[model samples]
Target: MTEKEWNGDFDPMADPEEQKTLLSVLDSLRSYRRLAHFNSTHVRRQAFYSLPSQHWTLLSQPPFSVLDSLSKLDDLIDSNAELAEAIFLEGFKAFMAPSLDSEWVASIVPEKYAHDEYQIYSIVMDHLNVQTTQGDMDKARSCVNQFYREWSAEGNMERGKCYEPIINALYTEFTARSQDILDLDKSDLKVLVPGAGLGRLVFDVCRAGYTVEGNEFSYHEIMASSLVLNHTDKAGQFNIAPFALGCSNHLSRADQFRTYSIPDVHPRSLLESEGTEEKVPPYERMSMATGDFCVIYSQPSYKGAFDVVATVFFIDTAPNIIRYVEAVRNCLKPNGLWINLGPLLWHHASRIQCSGDENEENNDDLKYHGHIDAGVGDPGSVELTDEEVVALVKHFGFEIERHEPGSVETGYISNRKSMLQNTYRASFWIARKK
Candidate 1:
């Protein structure tokens, strides 16, 4: 057992007196190693420092300083252990505390963002984890549906509140860059926003006079974005030209209103009659579309077709980076542009797999360890190094245009203190097709 000693200035290899002090310090560190339960290898390392006169001069400083530093490190570990225990105890109390009054539910959520019906229902389901009755399930569903409706309405009302600043920043950056490559005033452009969460950026592009449509996979996200788009002042700014809004079910149904009569564009899918059967109306199909941009590479669509594609916080979430890049390539035309922003941190493999079997233990050993809401569905996550990411994009035949830090504030959000620990940092890049 080595116990570390704190000698103000004990040199390892010096006069006989200094050697004695260094030996004593090494002995103390050895003792502390045993007391602190450090591994046997650490104890051996400390014991090596105890040897007299041989490797004394090799040490960077007085051996006593190293010993003292080790002692302080031990103290830090102990303090961290205590803090973790306290946090665990507090979490247990919060989890097992007595049920609150049902009326207090409203107070639990902030008034501004309180209408998350599904979230509230999820909380209720979590509270009642045991097998539930049909009635209870139905009630939960109703509560969640109502919450969703209210949340949608609330988001519509506050569409431009906090989101506007971020969107405006993105728009300003993108518009300025676009002007450099294309004639913004003269060129007729079409824009597509994939994974268009909230669609705020889509609205911004539309307002800039480009024909734009948002493509989102999630029903909830699309609905939320639609609500915001419908209610925001910029709704009218959308390119209402007949060629902008493609032939789709929504547009066809909207055609009853004279104001909604748009120019006829090719339907994404066509219906065929089977052996003299009645002809069916064409149905809308979702596929990546492309259009010309003076500076087209920013958009991810068929090569040589689009001027630019804007992707924010998107690529890092794909489980298969290679496949994701391929998809981007398929969407962009030759000489098209791809613009991106957000953290470049690779997501954990579990998140990308969508296996739902991920637990805290599994996450502990991950390269990018972080906590998420317990019941949030498996989020597709991935993390890649800058070189790897660039390689993947290059493999798809795109050349890097510009890569730099984004201006957005990101990382763990805390009311007390912000922790900007970046295993992987954020980057903004504009790539162009060869």
Candidate 2:
């Protein structure tokens, strides 16, 4: 914990010293610790800095600065650092939304984040702004490549498995319009995406001609996504060396160091052209709201506020699954549709097996650490069986439209060439408010 401390000489915070002291004790929570270190482990590490310190004098020597100036070491230092700087310093963090600013991140623990057991909210904010650790570099690298999965065309296959169903479910309602009109007036429709990581699903839904709002609770995601959604000017406006820091599962260095361009689709050009009437783009239709899902959308005004609520790989984030069900039922209009696709990887109720090819057969081998959202479905969350989940939906006044278990198989931000690939045989369903 002491090693996570920054040098005392330079102040990363403007607040009093006592505000920075409790972060070490607060770092024990699994989710909090991940967000706290996301930015710190991401940039300007010893690996990148070591090159310049040792080679400052090399440029002054004969072949280095002259005709033979660029070396493999020079390439390593320049390329990796340049990319890291763009993503962390000059890019995303520069445009972070005020809602995701350091202070807000510390307080946003879904339902119980700021409760008695997790009181170091301000200290956690301080840690998010300044803490650093070296061992988490691999996690940082995976996060970097996540941009590829969400924003690049290369990720369409993986993203499509989860995203397409949700998008198509929303689109099905639009199909009833007259055949002559292509992309007819969908301005009346509203869509909500919770756990909208990096906002790709939000972006796609907005592009498809619906008024879309994405709700998010993670600062680590919103900080990085804001730059792309708001500031990027064109398709492929930014390039990342996504796999440069990963050292394992590569058949070759070429796989690790490959460059990937983000944002296969431009944000401003969401309104696709049809009859050449020069339609004014409806930029106002898209928005991202920040805060815990159960808290923010639970407002009186949000009741029956949306026509469709689309979730993909997100429902599992709930500390209590019933809160999620209630949130959906309350926010949706009568007969409004709820579309969900994700494995029941309950975030709060249980633990998982570490290594193996996870499958329906092996899934039963999973063990639990606490009370799961099962049997009787109590408040702290019990892991309910598939049929029990359907029962929960019916009890909450949702008529099951369809239940297709193990219908979707998709990888999450997978490294295709790696020795292993893990895919989910996800649960998918559509329910109408009765």
lDDT of 2 by residue, 1-434 (tens): 01111011122123333222212212222222244234333332333445675574564465434212223223433443333333343222232222245455644645554553323343334446633323223333444567878988888999999988887888786665425467677766788888888888887887777787887644345445665676567888766655544446877656755666777877655443421233334466677765557755766878999988998888776656788888898899887889999888776565433346663222321211121233112334468766788889899999999899989998887777776778889989999898
- Candidate 1 lDDT over 132-232, as tens digits, reads 22332222222222222122322233223323443454455457767786644412444556556545455445444444545543222332333333322
* RMSD (CA, Å), each prediction: 26.6, 12.6
Top candidate by TM-score: 2
Question: Best lDDT goes to which candidate?
Answer: 2
Stretches of candidate 1 off by over 4 Å are: 1-187, 231-305, 345-348, 351-382, 405-408, 411-425
Model 1 compared with the native: what TM-score? 0.38
